[model samples]
Target: MEKEHKHHISSYFAHGTVLVTLLVLTVITVVVAGLKLGPLSVFVALIIASIKGTTVLTYFMHLKYDKPIYRIMVFGVFLLFALIIGITFIDYVFR
Candidate 1:
């Protein structure tokens, strides 16, 4: 028995738009790095990086079209990562 798999096709224009958006975000990150915002710079960079990561995961990795369970799992992983980072920061601030 042969099982047929369904695939979702995305347009080149959509991918091009994603590429442009990522490039714009990279530029913004660079510009923000040049500013002397002290601790805020790290927060800003992390924020931008998180956005880029989500974009890559959603579109480039095709997670957007995946099942809801997969999305929930990814969210859980990200939540764990955030919690670890927060704990590290808290420890650093106190020490």
Candidate 2:
């Protein structure tokens, strides 16, 4: 017996909104790059990039409509990645 998969169809307006939001984020990234924030600039850029990546994953990739377990797994993976990066950053700072 095969289980039926329910498809979540996103509206055109919603996609358009997402596109506009991404464009706005890109603009913000450009603006941030032009500023001389020094060490904080990289952190800010990473934050913005993360937001953009999440937006793409959630809407464009239809991860938002996936099962809860899948979402939790993705979150865990991201957390692990962050932890590794944090550790690497700490090591670099101390060296």
Extract clashing residue pairs from model 2. none
Query: Which portions of model 1 show Cα errors greater than 4 Å?
Result: 1-5
Candidates' C-alpha lDDT = 0.90, 0.92
Cα error of candidate 2 at position 85, Å: 1.7
In order of listing, the candidates' clash counts read: 0, 0
- The local lDDT score (0 to 100) that residue 16 gets in candidate 2 is 96
Residue 13 C-alpha lDDT in model 1: 94
Q: Residues 1-95, candidate 1, lDDT per residue (tens digit)?
A: 54554766878998998999999999999999999899999999989998998998999888898777779999999899889999999989999
Which tens-of-lDDT digit does each residue in 1-95 have in candidate 2? Answer: 65668989999998999999999999999999999899999989999999999999899888999777778999999999989999999989999
**Candidate 1 TM-score over all chains jointly:** 0.84
Local lDDT at 27 for model 2 = 99
Against the true structure, whose lDDT is highest? 2
lDDT of 2: 0.92
